[model samples]
Target: MKLPKKIKRYCPYCKKHTEHKISLVSTGGKRSALKHGSIERAKKRGRGRGLGNKGKWGSKPAVTKWKRKTKSTKKTNILYTCQECKKSHGQKKGKRTGKVQIENKEKKK
Candidate 1:
């Protein structure tokens, strides 16, 4: 989806509405020390003592899928940085999309 490079919105730090620069909030780089990462490694090696099921209230599956799966599409979110105060506030969740673009006049052909 395409979004304006800048937006106008209420800035709590500025005490009024102001122009804000828009940017996509990234999911960030991978962390080897992630909680699930270590737990998965342990489960694979079969020391599965403490890492129980992380899902639903219904009856547990008869056969568990070791290869966890997730939705391909992720909900897009954005950050709006107030130009005056330089403070940022997270905008409401955006549409589900694989990518988002900041519409830039300079980059437009």
Candidate 2:
């Protein structure tokens, strides 16, 4: 779906409506190993070498997986980046589609 590159929206920080840059918010990558790597290693060592405790995930029966299906439509995350303050905001479930195509829609007379 095509969308306006710049949109007039409420800016809480600026306390007024301003033109914000339209962009797709990407799903961030996983955290680096340095931060929580040590903690996870300590946990594994304390627990046994094998899968000490298979949580709810492993407890489920894998044979029942085929019952559920994936959704046809996916909600795209639209990010509104304020040009003035340079702050970004996320719109939850903005538009549902399998694919996203960003483009400015010109005003028609």
Candidate 3:
């Protein structure tokens, strides 16, 4: 899907409509293993002392590449930056597409 480089959108900070710049919002970075309530932190604290059926904690069979199914497309999210207030906001919903492209003008053929 193709998107415009700039679009007129509502700016909450300015409390009015204004011209905004469009840009893609990339996925967040990897999570930290030492964060609070994380499984890694619990394991590090010697808390793996359960003796009964581990259920989800039990080891599972390894999955092969062919056995695992993955989606070919990804959900693309965009951000709108208010030109007047210099503030950026994101849409509530994201678009699912194979690819997203933003351009100011069409190339001359």
Q: Which digits, one per residue and each the tens of the lDDT, describe model 2 over residues 2-108?
A: 77788889988899999899898765655563365444454455533356453323434244564576787767888999999999888866677877877767555
Cα lDDT tens digits for candidate 1, 1-109: 7789987789988889898999888755656744664654655665534556534222343244435557667777798999998999985666788668888743333
Name the candidate, 2 or 3, with the larger TM-score value. 3
Best by lDDT: 3
Q: Write one digit per residue (lDDT tens) for candidate 3, span 44-90.
A: 77655568654333333234534686887888889999999899999
lDDT of 2 at 39: 41
In TM-score terms, candidate 2 sits at 0.55
lDDT for predicted candidate 2 compared with the true structure: 0.71
TM-score of every model versus the real structure: 0.58, 0.55, 0.63
How many Å off is the CA of 81 in candidate 3?
0.5
Give candidate 1's total backbone clashes: 0
Lowest summed lDDT across 10 adjacent residues in model 1 is found at: 54-63
**Clashes in each model (backbone N, CA, C under 3 Å)?**
0, 0, 0
Assess each prediction's global lDDT (C-alpha) against the native: 0.71, 0.71, 0.79
